[model samples]
Target: MILSQKLFVATLTAMFTFFILPLFFVEENANDYFIGFVVSSVTIPFIFTFGLLTSMLIGNFCHKYHLKKIISFLLHIVSGVICLMIFAVYIFITGGSPEGYIQTGLMIALLCITVFFYIDIVMKKKSK
Candidate 1:
């Protein structure tokens, strides 16, 4: 995929994972948590920036070694792990509650995988 497509995917995945997904997972203080997330306005950009940069680096590495199929599958896994780590760090840095961490982390991982795979499938179909 091109850089532009990667960036677009990153932005979409970040937005969906951080913004929309949280609404369903956060049981307590749903409004407050979401409000805090929106008010901070830092999480989205942070996720998107790191997600984009890391995916790009991984893409380049995969291309360099000509491990397209293996790396493509690994890329989704890596992205999910990277996103989970970023979320954990962000939560720690902000002193957010640990209670919802697992739920949110799982959501992030699943969303990342879903979005990346969906995009990959669509792109492949388009190319074919």
Candidate 2:
């Protein structure tokens, strides 16, 4: 399979297995169900859309400015941190416990890092 296609499939699988699966394992109540559904339906797509847009912008920038690998690494680290902050906010809004919030936020950060690594690998292969 093409690298991009493989990365896309892996990303989608991670999104479903790691993010969506948690909602199912959580206690199901009216509010929880609604919140989980809305988050899954809306937020996940929004994040993906934003990521796509960001990737496009990065691609353009790299073409024009010749960004170094270190710059790309730094950008990914910052993006991962920002995503973790958003996850924390979501947990707070949903009234999740501190421990739950922290754990989930960390998991999300790790996922974001994984995605960044995958993208970097694909991009590197393309450049070669």
Candidate 3:
């Protein structure tokens, strides 16, 4: 498959696995937890979709400017940092003591890695 296709699949998979699955697995008060999980699951797709779309825009901009390598590198770094920040916020908002905060952090790290890979692929394609 093309790199863009791969990125879309990966992004969707990451969103479902890292964000949605946790809602199913994490422990909390049954009613409140269910409500929170439902809300989060619904909202996460919007966030993920927005990020993916923005990444595509960034990739196109990089291609247009013939600065793919630099732009990709910068984007990966910024996105990774933002992902970390999101994890921090997730922890803080979820009562500052969610059971799976560590797992969520790790997942965010993995997502950052995935973002880096996508950025690298974009840079390589632009160079070619």
Candidate 4:
């Protein structure tokens, strides 16, 4: 996943440098490049970084509180809910679709919950 994440980031950086940056120098050719592609591609890094950082934060929170599995799961839900709050803010200010933000947030929360539960099970088996 780390390798894949790095590749994704590098690709986005290269694309921005090569394709998007050139648009600034040549204003007339701006129509040659697709705005939607550039906008959407830029979001890839933000979602990926947010997911990773939020997952780490949740893990640390669980450890610090000595939370049970159920409580940890609930915490994930709470964090996911916070994403909706962000969605609402975007709607009010930006007037763009918020589905992607909501989906990314929920998916990352689910992924983190799944990993935590899987690791918990493995640790329990080792104890036995």
Q: What would the TM-scores of all predictions be?
A: 0.66, 0.54, 0.47, 0.44
Best of the candidates, TM-score? 1
Candidate 3 TM-score versus the reference: 0.47
RMSD after CA superposition, every candidate = 3.6, 5.4, 6.2, 10.5
Residues 1-128 of candidate 2 have per-residue lDDT tens digits of 33464448446645545655565355757887777678668666766666555555655576679997667556656666666677677777888755665666566656665665566566558767
- Give the Å error, residue 12, model 3: 7.0
- TM-score, prediction 4: 0.44
Model 1, 1-128: lDDT tens per residue?
57778776666666665566656644676787767678448765665676667767776787798886656667767776767776677667898865566575676567676776577557646768
Task: By TM-score, rank the candidates, best first.
Answer: 1, 2, 3, 4
Q: Write down the worst ten-residue block by lDDT for model 3.
A: 1-10
Model 4 per-residue lDDT tens digits across residues 1-128: 43344344344444444453443335455554576357547645554465446645776787788887677667656765665566557665887776665665456445544554455445445657
Measured by TM-score, how close is model 2 to the native structure?
Answer: 0.54
Instruction: State which candidate has the highest lDDT.
Output: 1
Clashing pairs in 4: none
Better of 2 and 3 by TM-score: 2
- Better model by TM-score, 3 or 4? 3
Model 1 misplacement above 4 A: 12-23, 26-30, 68-70, 93-99, 124-128
Q: Regarding TM-score, does 1 or 4 come out ahead?
A: 1
